[model samples]
Target: MAGVRQFDEDSAFEQALEVFRAKGYRATSMLDLAKSTGVQRGSLYNAYGDKEEIFSRVFERYADRFVADARVALNKAGLREALVEFFVFAIRSITQGSPARGCLSTKIAVEIASESPRQQELVKKMLDELEDVLVGVLQSPEARAQLVIPPRQAARIIVTMTRGIAVMERVYSDPKRLRQTASALIDTMVRPG
Candidate 1:
């Protein structure tokens, strides 16, 4: 009889994501994923093809979760508060799983962005969507009333600051400082100019 899958697909994918995020695409091996997910090497190959393919799935999942989580900022009461919280959340998430891991998208974007077209497109699409989210919020009448720059420009600034925070998380694990940095950025943004 063919061996039945003892692993849940969703659970296996989640496990694989953690491994990819921690070790990265070029560093992770099929054995590593199988061992981590308890799925066995042959089975993993049969199901997921190779490390690149598996990491692709993980990358897409990460993108989905990121965009979804980022939308939470828009749901908050105030635009300035939302921008601050949004960046604080990004920094926190980047620093969340393991200090060594940093942010998966940022890691891949910096590491293999030039080499991999897929990675480049994914990073671009996700970031563009995130900035668009910020633009939507910043274009609000409330937000427009206080802005020194255009909404699109303001959104770019917010995204840039948050991306900086994500990069900064590599060396800094202090959530308080991250939050303060984000708060300071927002303070400067909303201040009259």
Candidate 2:
């Protein structure tokens, strides 16, 4: 008899991530994961322990990808260029994706922040990480000495603006408008007064 081929854990996690991305964490069910991953419900439980565990795994994978992308953006030639690339990458990922799912962390933050402390903390961590990356790219010390705005504050502004843009893209299908808005944001940030 031929041996059965088993799906790898990473592949299963990727499938689950796609489902969770399309449907928010609370909205996703075990059946959904099973259907999406081509795994039996019992097998899913055996592999990942539980729904929250699976979500945690998916979240970790997603965060790793996001941070990797941010690192790449920050490593580009100049600060302004890096920031522009970061924003453009975000716009493209959110607007052009198959499921058209916005940022998973952002979606969860807006919906569940008030409901669970754990979720709120996760959201806060995600935002803080993004801000930290922005601060590094903006060259915080120089920006502060110039009195343009404090590094921390500017980082918060960038994260907030990006989050808002992502939310808008999730609801609106106006690609040209989003592209224009993203460009305007990059220009404003890059311009020296």
Candidate 3:
């Protein structure tokens, strides 16, 4: 094996993800990624091309996991529980570290606006996938009975509110407030008619 990687690729990507989440894409440099990942800069370049390439890889993994988690959270027994759990899942996601990093995809979407079309498209696609998952949950037989609006409209509302929660998590960093907000959203959005 002439060029087999000597370091842990998965661990490096996880560290790179943390760096990007903390500092955003443009603020994070190759050296930052290397130091965070414990990987040599030259080795990083050789193994993963450049900063953008590494970010792309990390973003893809994150996007997949995010959507999968959404589906799981939205599959709870009752509509209120499902939506509440989804928001709880989302709040937990953004509040992982000390000061809260917020949603990485949402942060990257705002951070890279007017920068890279490719990154913009990636973010958009992830959002659309999330919205679709919400729609599916809203349209489920258990959820449909309690819906006050069309499933698509409700899904969009959920998506927008989810993004807002991410931003507010950074601003307030209070899980209790976020949970209250989620409860209010569930009440307003899913009242029986």
Question: Which candidate model has the greater TM-score, 1 or 3?
Answer: 3
Worst 10 residues of 1 by lDDT: 92-101
TM-score of each: 0.89, 0.85, 0.93
Report the C-alpha lDDT of model 3 over 20-88, residue by residue, as the tens digit: 998999999999998999999999999888888899999988999999998998888888888888998
Sort the candidates on TM-score, descending order: 3, 1, 2
* lDDT per residue as tens, model 2, 77-164: 6556666687777776676576577788888787776787866776777778878887876765544444356667767887888788
Best by lDDT: 3
Off by over 4 Å in 1: 1-6, 98-101
Tens digits of lDDT, candidate 1, 10-82: 8888998888888888888898998889898988888777877778887788888888899985678777767
Better of 1 and 2 by TM-score: 1
Give me candidate 1's TM-score against the actual structure: 0.89
What overall lDDT goes with each candidate model? Answer: 0.81, 0.76, 0.88
Of the candidates numbered 2 and 3, which has the greater lDDT value?
3
**Which residue pairs show backbone clashes in model 3?**
none
C-alpha lDDT of residue 63 in model 3 = 95
